[model samples]
Target: MIKIAAMGDNVVDCYLSKGTMFPGGNCLNVSVFIRRFGGVSAYIGAIGQDEAGSVIEKALHDENVDLARLRILKGATAYCVIGHRDADRVFVRADLGVSMFSPSSEDIAFLKDFAAVHIGQSSGLDDHVSAAAAQTLLSYDFSTRRDPEHRRTIAPLCFLASISGGDLSHDEALAIAAELRDCGARWVLVTRGSEGAILLGAEGLFEVAASPADLVDTLGAGDTFIARTLFGLIAGETPHALLSAAAVAAAETCRYFGAVGHGAPIKLSGVVPELQTISS
Candidate 1:
């Protein structure tokens, strides 16, 4: 089994339109998604030991995600109240002290045992949680700065870095990707939302269009896409397989409100029909 570990922000995502609360944060979502698809995933992140935290923890356990690395504090769990309409969601988040914990020495050692590790800059990085994984696949965020510690550690690792068009222009995105190649990542995938995503790989640049969908809430779609695509990569599935699976997962996310909607139930088998390979 390919052991996957994901570390990042953990939040109680409350969806106003759906009138529901779900556990989220890019790392938590990826970990749960991977576990649901038959991979062993360890979810490592911090949460405040409050009602919100309890709910989030139970949700993860219900999803069958291993939470041995989950950290709970006396403070309130990080939270986001999301309001959504068709294809767009606005978020109001709380930044508590819980975001300051990076993977401990034990956490780092544990992660090295996995086949791959995924970290997200959901809140951007500060001194604490930035670059927590030293020896695994990184999902780089262009909106977040690379932790100096992580940058040095990942210089020899294989990984993917991405930025939203909201964060960069096409030219700037391309330049930043090359910079990542210089710093460490083996590949860069610049996602331009409706414009689609561009993959800069050893095989050269591959750009693909967004799969068709009735846009509901774009929240969590990017995270879902990256999680499923990485699963395909680890499963030795074809590039086409990865693209399709990710597209389906992302499309599913848009059918409901908030980051995870009813779409969170998707498995690898369900995504095959939704995928179409674009010209490379």
Candidate 2:
């Protein structure tokens, strides 16, 4: 089985509608979808001891994902308030809790068994895991970096990268991806929401048009796309086939309510005995 370790932030995504919560955050979401696609996935990060943290813990367990690396702390759990406008979501704001969760050498050693490591936009954890993931394939989601310093920092670490093209045109996005490659990324994937995804790497540059679907909450579509793309690559599918598969999977995620909802969350009681002693 393909083993992948996802290290970084985990957030409790709270919807503004009725205060409904979901387990999210780029790396956590990726791990869920990776497991859904048959990969042996593990999530490595710090989750708070609050009620929201319990929700995240229960959700991960229900998804059948490995949670041996999760660290519990006393701080408030990180969360984002998602506002909805029809089928689309608007990011209201976020309180970044546990955004600074960086694993130590022991944690990195545990991740060495995985074929690849997926890094999230969790401040310093990207750099922290890059060294540990050196022997393994490392991929990161840069989100969108308009800052030159941030772009430079992203370079020379991860083998593959994913970023959102906010308002850049086709040509502009291509240029940006090329620049990212020059910086250090072996492959640069630019996601353009409904437009589709453009993948630029050593083999060649290719574009995958978006699959049409009934839109719902766009919470974890990008995470699903990344997970599917990685799955296809691990399965030895061609680039074109992988890209197409990823696009379709991402579109399928929009058909659901929030990320991979395998079933209802299993309510967890009491503090995590093993995790309670750990500090943030």
Regions of candidate 1 where Cα sits further than 4 Å from its true position: 123-133, 143-158, 166-171, 261-280
TM-score of 2: 0.89
Tell me the TM-score of each prediction against the true structure: 0.80, 0.89
Clashes of each: 1, 0
The TM-score, computed over Cα atoms with residue i paired to residue i, of candidate 1 is: 0.80
lDDT, candidate 2, equals 0.77
Instruction: Write one digit per residue (lDDT tens) for candidate 2, span 1-280.
Output: 8988788877776653543567788888988998988889998888898777877888889878899988988787777666778877777766777656767787888877888888866545755755765657888888766665776777567667888775678998988888888898777888888889988888899899999989988878888888888777767788899899898888999997766653323222332222223222
For model 1, residues 1-280, the per-residue Cα lDDT tens digits are 8778887777766654444566677777788778866789998888876666767788888887788888887665666666654568766444443744666778777776777777665644433333443555555454345444554444335466655554567786677666667776776666667766666666566666788889877877777777776777778776666776777777787776656532232121222111122110
Worst 10 residues of 1 by lDDT: 271-280
Model 2 residue 58 lDDT? Answer: 89
| The candidate that achieves the highest lDDT relative to the unseen native structure | 2
Total colliding residue pairs, candidate 1: 1
